[model samples]
Target: MVKAKQINVNNLPISILDINEDDYFCLTHMTKNQQEGSKIIEKWLTNKNTIEFLGVWEQLNNPNFNSHEFGGIMSEAGTNRFYLSVKQWVERTKAMGITARTGKYGGTYAHKDIAFNFGLYISPLFNLLLIKEFQRLKEIENNQYGLEWNVKRILSKANYHIQTDAINNYIIPTLNYSQKKEWIYADEADLLNIVLFGCTAKQWRDANPERSLNGENIRDIASINELTILSNIESLNSTLIKNNVDKKNRFKILLETVQEQRRTLDNIDFIKSMK
Candidate 1:
């Protein structure tokens, strides 16, 4: 399903849809303040230059675009008898740059490239305001995304330390290693890694040589959801270690916890947004 968002361009609310990772702005909303609602869009679609612009855009971005049909439409543009709608254009040309959506947010939405051009057609001032407002919205979203990602990464690190502390206090005492006891910490970390990711650090690095070459480890590139889950399992594994649970039993419990938490988090929209 497409996600809808809105931005107020000079006090006029314009809707935007997330269509397959591309933003499509509501052309209907852009013309709503005018005397003519959709007629403006209809007029714009009949312009020969507009048809050419759309044809070129579709050719560049949509491999499925029917150039044969577009050529036929282009030839009739600007004629007294010629008329076109957003739906007709899409149906005839297999266009991806614009769509006619129905429902609560129903409108003629065009890809940002086309929408900006339409904004320019409306007025240079309106186009400027729309671009500025859209960029501001994107900046806010980017800032929020970065903030949450850093928070999750930091939380995972803090919990990792807590788990290591448990290893030092409990697990390390029973181990026989004298000078090279660091393997104990590595083993415990790998236990959590294996349970959650189904791979050890070395195994993951081996499988992803390019990422490894760039100095990014498995956790470094994990999604916000995965980091949250890793933090949870780390804390839980520490508790299990303090309770003197054997490594094998702890692995089983951590594995089960990882599976359950993933299933739960996967369904949460808020968590999905963070990613």
Candidate 2:
């Protein structure tokens, strides 16, 4: 799947496409503010060194690349009549390193390796700036992912301790059978699931066989907002459990809490950043 993202390079928003986990930078957007940006790309394409570099990249990365056509283009490169367009290069050599996209993100995009080479044609300073900005963008994304992972871990720990402490302290002692006592934790977890997700874990699994086959649970696919509401309610439910509230009354309070917190968090866009 191809995903489109953008980054600011030298104050210009350049389009980047994520194709099969590789980032392809938009060469057209790189020089969009310059005079005759198209001509600049054309000049870069006609360079013999650029041609050789692109050919070698295609040979290395593209299994179905048309080496015969690439050799012909390479021979004619840097000659007076030699000219190449992004479309021509892609079609002739079956190149996967560059692409001409259409629609909203339409542009001539190149793989990062080829993009850095093309960046030199823009300017040494501009190229350096582009590299720096790209690195910064990647760092931000990595940090965000790491933070979310940590939040999930902390939520899991909090939920486990709060709910099990309540169960072991209050509910477990009343059950006569050991098997019934063992089920207390799962039953308590399902209470939270029913409140936030409108279904029990078992019900969710039954409804989604493929996901169940892949070892995913309802909570595994939950949005950030849903998880936050779940965390809030688990703590609330723990308090209710400790206070000796009956199951029916505790369910009502937890449901209300879930609804109220969801309404509050949904309105705040930052808190609703879904995975």
lDDT comparing candidate 1 with the true structure: 0.89
Question: Pick by lDDT: which candidate is best?
Answer: 1
Which tens-of-lDDT digit does each residue in 1-275 have in candidate 2?
56777899767998888888899999999878778876788889899999999999998999999999999998998789889998999999899998888887888889999998888887898899889989998898877765775586479658768888888888877875667755788888888888888899999999999999999888888876787777777888888899999999999998888888888977764422654
Off by over 4 Å in 1: 206-215, 271-275
Give stretches of model 2 more than 4 Å off.
166-275
Name the lDDT value of residue 268 in candidate 1.
68
Native-structure RMSD, model 1: 2.5
Candidate 2 displacement at residue 244 in angstroms: 16
Error of 2 at 150 (Å): 1.1
